[model samples]
Target chain A: MKEKLTDSELIAMVNGGNQQAFSELMKRYRKMVARVVIGMLGDTPEADDVGQEVFVRFYQSISSFRGDSALGTYLTRIAINLSLNELNSRKRRFLFFSVKDDEQPLPDLADEANVDESLSRNELIEKALAHLDPKFRSVILLRLIEGYSTKETAEMLGVPLGTVLSRLTRAQDRLKEIVSKLSREMVINTADTTAKVKVKTELK
Target chain B: MKSKTFNPEKNIGNFFENYDADFKPFFETRVMARIENMVMSYQMNRDFAFRKIFMPALATLVVVFVLAVIMGQGISVQSLMGWTNIDMESAIASSMGY
Candidate 1:
């Protein structure tokens, strides 16, 4: 899908001390990196931060690459690993209990914005995506969200095509279920609120 | 063969319909900034390598050339000018057989 300088050309330019070529490589893979970050971070501000860090890391180590994998695949793997690390650290700090600060436990998820209410269609899709585990989510994002073909996704994730297919199918099914559940809840909540309001008015 | 239902394309399209061009724009600047940062790092690395390698190599060559010239002048010119001559034949014979 990408057409421009080949990996060898870019590597040569980079080794030759050509900053412009390095810039070109960044432009080439920026979207791919951003998508992978977004998949893991679920549209948070941190996705961009994490995505930027991935490229920075990639650029730092570009000289050491042995050309075993495609450059794009290499960058994506770095992005995925970094994004997962960020997510894990955030969860540990925020989601689980901390003994150090016992002054009023952190507000439950109820205090956080509702995923179903604030999310746009794309955000809803992303929110639904948050339900799947990272392995499946990586494959799904690469295949469905990023529109990479099956073979491409397999290559990117370094998994067999069969594995990609199965994981993607499962991931899609899981996302569909999550979205349906959220939509149903929204409807039920709206109906319940209306009913309660009507009953209170009649009593008054 | 219970029932095959749900079009994959339709579902795929639904996912794409969620694509946020706005979000994409927000990320573009971020990505470019990242690229710039990477480029800066690469430049720094290149600078480091040049200093670490090429500069030292040049320095070594310069030192070796100066030493070689000084040694050559001290030995070769004195011998050639015969400023401290010993018998050449004796010198050759002694050096050969000594």
Candidate 2:
């Protein structure tokens, strides 16, 4: 019967100090939260940190949940806000250190990634996605990766539907740009390694 | 070089469509433990605040009542603040028989 109860029912129980109900709620939605967060944050430790904070904040504010929106949406909204905060702070830190985006560029980031023939296409895409600006990456995460509707993504981001649309277009363009850079880096790195091997063979 | 028309939405889907978000086994345990700690700390804070603010006020009220009865005197915010408005003094003196 507990398993059959709706999100509102579980929330009511959680408000009444039922930890099991809260755990059930977390189990039900943690994967979705992880996808949205990890998509935006990659598989870094920061993603794990934000992922935990989402549920913790939800637990803290469980009493105020009126069920106006789906519980999933409510939780996803928290995840997005926290992830965006971390991204914004990171950008500020970068700015404080006088790191300009144009000066740093995507290929430079890809040069630091684990690129080899052993890497899958998915891994390559993930690495390419890391180079995307956080705003555009957020659009990609919510709209394309998580497959939320445009209106839903707008509501999640607290932006206009048209803004989500335009951001989606620009995000796609940026993703393409990064992937192209990634591919070019892949070629250059492969060639460089091969030339090194040829020189070693000649010396031998 | 052959130019490729980049389809972001489709490619993003391609990368993440089969994405599996696997949590370490301790994730749920860690979260539940944190939630419990949060609840405990919150209850502790409420109890602490109640003890901090309410107990002293209750004690002061009891002490004031006992002293007022013992001394046959009036207790009032006006008298406490040493204000001497005529109407207030008369009303308070009449009310407290002091």
Candidate 3:
């Protein structure tokens, strides 16, 4: 069965121009790729597009893949690179338009049936992540969220191990600060809503 | 009141572990479709290049080579650069005061 094929087998089939094999490969690694992309870029449409581009790039270079690294690692590398590129362009756009970072809209969560506690928490997490510098963000996502080893994260990012360690320390410190601030704002917002509701009920 | 401790590391790990990072429904189908479109476009561009650019350029090269050979000039840097009439041996000898 195609599902039982190893990465090397799938890669060989793909190199032989088997589209179905490539599709199977994509299906197999989509979650891993999605996690890296979405973690780095947030759950924006650009993340989705980058997710697709990762596989497309692999397909284009199938003939030369050589299978030195596992397919998952290779795809994660592409996702990270593409996500960083998206982040750079986002920085450029923000600077060019002189847009206040806070004015940027929250990621859409309307499709969910219940946009309650979990939704807000996720939104807070995303906001906190968005505040990180891309370099720090990448290390946090890979080392913490995706649960890759620090050395693995460094290899994937093409950075030295010491750099990853230093970045991880700094990134964690910055993330704690950002998350604390966001959590405080969330608490204030909830209290404000409760007070407004109490007043409205009393007026009625 | 018991104060709650904030641990970003544990919170981040827990949050992302439960996070559904899956793409929308039929994402694989969409990706496959895009790959097909890309492959088709690449093949089309390659074909177009072979037809419009490569073939004509190759034909021109062959024609020029044939013309050069037929005219007995051969295909050398001198002949191609319009220096076919120069007598390099005698010119070099005279320059050296032979």
TM-score of chain A of each: 0.67, 0.78, 0.79
RMSD of each: 9.2, 5.7, 6.2
Q: Which residues of candidate 3, in runs, are more than 4 Å off?
A: A98-121, A184-204, B1-15, B53-98
Candidate 2 per-residue C-alpha lDDT over A41-73 given as tens digits, one digit per residue, 9 for 90 to 100: 777888888899999999878898888888888
What would the DockQ be for model 3? 0.31
Give the clash count for model 3. 0
For residues A1-204, what per-residue lDDT tens digits would candidate 1 score against the true structure? 236779778878877877667667777777777667887677787887787788667767878988887787788778878977886787678865644321222222343244233335555556656766777778877777667789977876778999998987877776666656555554555566678789999999
Per-residue lDDT of model 3, residues A108-146, tens digit only: 333223223323555566666777778888898888777
Q: What C-alpha lDDT, on a 0 to 100 scale, does residue B10 get in candidate 3?
A: 62
Q: Is the docking of candidate 1 incorrect, acceptable, medium or high quality?
A: incorrect
Ten consecutive residues with minimal summed lDDT in candidate 1 chain A?
A100-109
Question: Of models 1 and 2, which has the larger TM-score?
Answer: 2
Q: Is candidate 1 or candidate 3 better by TM-score?
A: 3
Query: In model 2, which regions exceed 4 Å deviation?
Result: A98-104, A108-117, A180-204, B1-12, B73-98
Residue-level lDDT for B57 in candidate 3: 89
lDDT (Cα, 0-100) at A1 in candidate 2:
40
